[model samples]
Target: MSDSAPTEHVLLTPGPTPLHPRAVAALLRPMLGHMDPEVFAINDEIQADLRTMYGTAPDTFTALLSGTGSLGMEAGFANLVESGDEVLVCVNGSFGARMAEMAERYGARVRVVTAPHGQAVRVEDVAAQLSGVQMVAVVHGETSTGVLNPVPEIAQLLRGTDTLLTVDAVTTAGMQPFDMQGWGVDYAYTGAQKCLSAPPGVAPVAISERALARFAARRTPTPLWYCDFEGLRDYWSRRAYHHTVPVNLHFAFHAALRAALDEGMTVRQRRVREMGAAIQTALAPLGFSPYVQREAERLPTVLALRLPEGFDDAGIRAALRRREISVTGGLGPTAGLIWRLGLMGEAARPAPYRALMTALEDLLGERGVAARFDEALAGVPV
Candidate 1:
């Protein structure tokens, strides 16, 4: 008997992965005023849980911005960077490049250190450009190519300096370890939809006291008031008004956080890691090699795979959609060359992996590559 990809969630994709059942249920509950006492209670829960996920001190400033992860990225720069400050960005993939662009737009004198799309950014290369920059920005997980950067090593380089280290944790927040306080990172952000299993729109961010101090001492005013660190903190931490908080998304986010904690972050991270390893091991011989060639650096939640040279990318994606399955394709440079299969949140378990492999086996048979890939995956696919 063959397992089938889940139809309920449209299977999976990198971001906006299927929501936890609790989050789904939370969405149906009655809405609350953004400033209601119950909503304040909810905000407190979200802030506390998000801090734990980010591995930050209790006093660290954390908030849920009213936008997607991209908004979180923009907030990181807009709050910390003022005109003429030098910002160095490490670009190994699309998200890194986005940081470079955001920094420039925020009026930072931006410089970039880059690696090819499929590779991880080197800590040594970042060290070379570390001098005199106001901040060194990097993406902890590059979902575009499934590579995890050396964030702790890079953060270590800025230990004693005035220069801050900012990170884009959009894709790794819940599935991988985040030691913002221990790693000495000043600013970082993640989306609700990814590993949090919440709906889209709310992006959680963590800010160290060090970064908050710098924000307070900025020479010029923050470019955006809506997501400015002080305003967001005032709203989430002090219950002061900033924007009309997405009350329902908060309900979902709170429920999702509870579910992740219920599973234990350690267990959740291990589950995602094991899933990636199993998929890579089972699929390699069948022509689905990892885009990140080095096994150690690949992202566990978003498994980016190389499509065989002659495989028709569009056709495969369409076929998967017909089966109510969803997988992301590469962006920019890697487009038409790779598949980003996300095994995240509720989908990280064996049922989803078994479903994915079954679909792949059927697709392979259709392509006449193998009548059965079950032999390759054997007992490991699930």
Candidate 2:
């Protein structure tokens, strides 16, 4: 590979995070037929690991899809939502809104309960919304604004109701503690690229028997043939072909799951928490306050910080790129007002954390903005 061949840059944004070295090699492994016994063994290992990571025992049904997280989202909705079904979507970020749109596209009667972009969706509000709803959907970790929703409480609220609970754990899966069975989360999905430290293109989905039964009894066929859960489940379970699985991406996911197990979920969660604390501490004295008020409510892997009074967000982002650092600008309501910093998987290490802080300080200082570089770095605990 030529060094100047537009060298792939390190991704510091939330999803499709920086990949582990071993995961890269796994992706390069020779591909096998999806129906091969060896490949099926690999799939079995991946499913078992997913069960462990999700903290669910007998109640979980796991499947790997040949697309990104959004595909899993569609799968979950398309299977449960038929025409005239009532769906309540809790919207606090971009992903939640996407869920609502998907439900509507499936011909369900969709009701949206929205909160401010950086705020959590209140469980009480969701409970009220669930009065006549068949399903309730939320984003467990809203990557758009770095807010972690109260999924446990929300799940508890919907326990005995007819409303099924579905969560989008794309950014939270490997970096936090998620008990799907314990919390009664009927359906959930995650992408392989975020905290899994794998390349993009595969999504892992978990469905409870309750959700599966709902799919079996759907009155109308799902609008999308490709994402129909019943058909896909037949293929994935019997090793029959509904569509070609992305064989190389499965290799990458297998290696990524091994890395996650090696690190242990507790250790990985601690590392993510420590990195978030360090970044928050380092930026405080430099006049960069977090957009979210309560630190505990924020997702550890992604941080949204307010930009300096006069600094342009896009300009600062461009400056960071010039220095070989990649940070994202906010989306929707936060656009141009905040910068999103992601510390996920391999990219969540101390080296990248320190580098980002130092680079930001230098850029600000050179632009004639006053900042205490030494004090900021010193404030970061060892």
lDDT of 1 at 367: 39
For each candidate in turn, the TM-score is 0.93, 0.93
Candidate 2's C-alpha runs over 4 A off are: 1-8, 366-382
Local accuracy of candidate 2 as per-residue lDDT tens digits, 1-382: 5666674564678767889887999989898988888888999888888988887766477878889999989988888888888999989999999999999998889998888888899888887777788898999999999899999998998877778999999988888989999998888899999889998899998888888888888777777888788767776677777888888889899999889988898888877777766677667756778898877678887888887688777887898888777889889888888878887788887766556767776877642122333333344442
Best by lDDT, which number?
Answer: 1
Score each candidate by Cα lDDT.
Answer: 0.85, 0.83
Off by over 4 Å in 1: 1-7, 366-382
Per-model RMSD to reference: 3.7, 2.8
Q: Give the TM-score of candidate 1.
A: 0.93
The clash numbers for all candidates, in the given order, read 0, 0
